[model samples]
Target: MPLCSGYMAPEYAMDGLFSTKSDVFSFGVLVLEIVSGKKNRGFYNSDHELNLLGYAWKLWREGKGTELLDKSMGDVCSVHEVLRCLHVGLLCVQERGEDRPTMTSVVLMLSSESASLPQPKLPGFCMGWNPNETDSSSSKHDESFTVNQVTVTMLNAR
Candidate 1:
């Protein structure tokens, strides 16, 4: 999934940032993308920078989570189950790691019809700026700084 490739890359591990919670976030993103048939990254509109997660959040908050479902899957899926999945997915992607549910909790919420789920907090990195706009001078400088830091750290560890 994109999360494994994006957030959980080995480079992130170098910073000791890898955690089960991060995996939960990735899984949540995957679930939303799968249900919506859209990519979470680079999802945009003229009105908002929201990825699929943001869209889902807005729908959920508006009591319209069902609206986020893929139209192709109409009547083939249970509305309650779909909503529950969306809720769990949102919980997994909350900005605060501590606010995110564990993968075990996610599995339970997905599998059990009777489980009570807490409301999900806001998701992380929901900014709408085009991620590929590395053309800006400031972005170039940031990239160089990151690359240099990685190089120096690696050399020092070796």
Candidate 2:
């Protein structure tokens, strides 16, 4: 499957390579979105000048991870579990495919409270915006495409 600019992993977006790791990346973004109640795509924080992932990482590093939680949950949610979800999300979004945990590992981490989790590196899309930086979204890939004029992508994992 061709990659969409948003939610596409570096491997797939940069080299047209699609695999389970690519899905892991997308799942990470989804987890972040669910936890923070924000969409990864079109999520721009002006103060930090970062996308959702970068902003979450920023909060995490500053010892303000709890602030990243959705306001509606408030004091009702379990802080430790929420933090673990964030940790797992970051692990799944590491820049390299090899750095990401498999879905099996992810499920285990999410399920077992005693499971030890490795610390996550910064994250992909960390430097989302820079005024003086040269950036372009116009890859050789089209903005979006259709298979037989159908908008949805259909592909099987190896």
Candidate 3:
């Protein structure tokens, strides 16, 4: 019953840069949610304040990718297939649009057992994006962003 607005691609939510690439990011988030049985938004993890993508990426980097899966589905699906989907999901959420796979490529990767896949880099919005986090470069950043609202625009000229 909740909207997972956090799954919106960073490049889109921050700057309104909608494209096929943005769709790919959203798809990745959905895949992660499905496999992990976690809401992309309104997720809570005491280990970190990161969103689903951020936490999933962390788990992947730690070589604990299987831990990100939903335990309920353990008996129903192949772990290899699940891991492949996780890999593809991470690939789709890469920070740069050009690095993301086209839908056709993603489909092939998902369906083929022999497909050669590349390791995925960090996801967009990789950090927790905590405003309370203090940085030494505070003077170089904007401090006016409120808790529930970000005055983002298509230009994103801030």
lDDT of each: 0.72, 0.80, 0.81
Clashing pairs in 3: none
The positional error of residue 49 in candidate 2, measured at the CA in angstroms, is 1.9
**Model 3 stretches with alpha carbons more than 4 Å out:** 1-5, 129-158
Model 3, range 53-78, lDDT digits (tens) per residue? 87888888998889889988867988
Candidate 1 wrongly placed segments (more than 4 Å): 1-16, 131-158
> Which digits, one per residue and each the tens of the lDDT, describe model 1 over residues 16-106?
5777787887888888877777777667545645657777888889999998888999899999888888888888878767788888888
| Pairs in steric clash, model 1 | 49-128
Judging by lDDT against the true structure, name the best candidate. Answer: 3
lDDT of 2 at 14: 79
Q: Using alpha carbons, what is the TM-score of model 1?
A: 0.72
TM-score of each: 0.72, 0.76, 0.76
Over all chains combined, what TM-score does candidate 3 have?
0.76
Ranking by lDDT: 3, 2, 1
Q: Compute the lDDT for candidate 3.
A: 0.81
For model 1, give the RMSD to the true fold: 6.3
Q: Worst lDDT window (10 residues) for model 1?
A: 1-10
